[model samples]
Target: MSDTHAPTTRLNKRMAELGLCSRREADEWIARGWVRVDGRVAGIGVQVAPGARIDIDPAARGHQQEQVTILLHKPVGYVSGQAEDGYQPAAALVQARSHWRGDASRQRFSPGQLRGLAPAGRLDIDSTGLLVLTQDGRVARRLIGEDSTVEKEYLVRVAWGEATVGVQPLVPPAALAKLRHGLSLDGRPLKPARVDWQNPEQLRFVLTEGRKRQIRRMCELVGLKVMGLKRVRIGAVTLGQLPLGQWRYLGPDERF
Candidate 1:
């Protein structure tokens, strides 16, 4: 008989919660006998207590090491994730010829790398700048997971009121203050952001959260209209001098 009152969770879910790997990968590892619980080989569908010791085999580590993460200087008009409404997904540009000539990683482009490549976060079709696509589940969870605290920085060009051309407009002090701290989107209060003017027409926005069209909606609420938006940095990685529409592998030494 089992002690039904004890708390338990699926092994895969516990591994994911501990940042070991995604649930799918955990299942595969368990099937291959690459995952162990309390020094015993764990099987698929196993349930584990909170204090169970979990370990992964060396083969699993090597498999994870081979997974690639790519950084792209996304151009406007490309959807960040999947193709929709006839717009191409940013992943479509990860071909051999499109690899940045300035890439120093020396990683050869391979079609096999595209097998499971997916964007970690989103950049709207109309926005441009740094975009991350990866085959590694760990990297994906690190950047887009619910508890991620990575900072994404953007340059936003905006126009006050209705005029977009030949007009220099300043953001009202009150509106700018609200932009930095107080605001709500989709009926929930937003986390504080680091927003300030980069120039007369552009604002620098550093946010830790990526809600759909969050910046654009936030600007609209403050009476400013976004004319252009470009993500310049995510975590410690910047778009750098990578030309538009080109990509490079995230170097082994790089983190987040």
Candidate 2:
């Protein structure tokens, strides 16, 4: 006997696949009667065939447009997420008083902007630079999701062994090559990275993966000690003159 299951999928999943919203958001909209299938309101867990027509209420789109993304020039000492060991989280710096005066965007600071806003990616307590916090789930998923291929660029200060007279304390070319490809952390090989020297004391790393303390660990593996690490860019967005401990809105035209 032949099997006879139709190729159907959950309504929420289909909505997410269509870039309308995330599955969770789709469920919320469905519960709120903001989603429709074949011109009728959809219900939670509803499944439909491949040809089903999905419609989202215009109000849902407006609400999504109001969601905000913030780019913080995080200073060292604050954890990226929750407060830990008495160290404040970077989100605490997003208050109105802390808004960057140099911000060219017309967006105004509001208390409601803080609600549900969360860090999209992490910056180690000891490191500093561009850190993203957002209320938009789509932006978070785009930047830190499992399949995200966004590149994060960092400038890391390193120290090799103490310099001796007539000798340089620099990482060898062979080791630098390894930083570009050959390395492992947590018993797994790392993805290939773009590692190059920015100056005598610093290395510029462009990586697609953000493992825990990853840059520091990568430097350690190459026999270099990371003295300071600062993320300068995530995808096309840059830290670009945003003063430390201040934030600015991700502009309308900006992506990633």
Clashes of each: 0, 0
lDDT of 1 by residue, 1-256 (tens): 3344679999999999998988878888899999988899998899988888898999999988888999999999999988999999999999999999999997899999998899999999999999999988788888999999999999999988766653235566889999998999989999999998887788899999999999999999989899999999999999999999999999988887
Candidates in order, TM-scores: namely 0.94, 0.91
Please list the residue runs of candidate 2 whose C-alpha ends up more than 4 Å from where it truly belongs after superposition.
1-9, 48-51, 163-169
In model 1, which range of ten residues has the least summed lDDT? 163-172
Clashing pairs in 1: none
- Candidate No. with top TM-score: 1
What do the candidate models score in CA lDDT, each in turn?
0.91, 0.88
Error of 2 at 175 (Å): 1.0
Report the C-alpha lDDT of model 2 over 163-233, residue by residue, as the tens digit.
42222245578889999998999999999999887877888999998999999998788788888899999
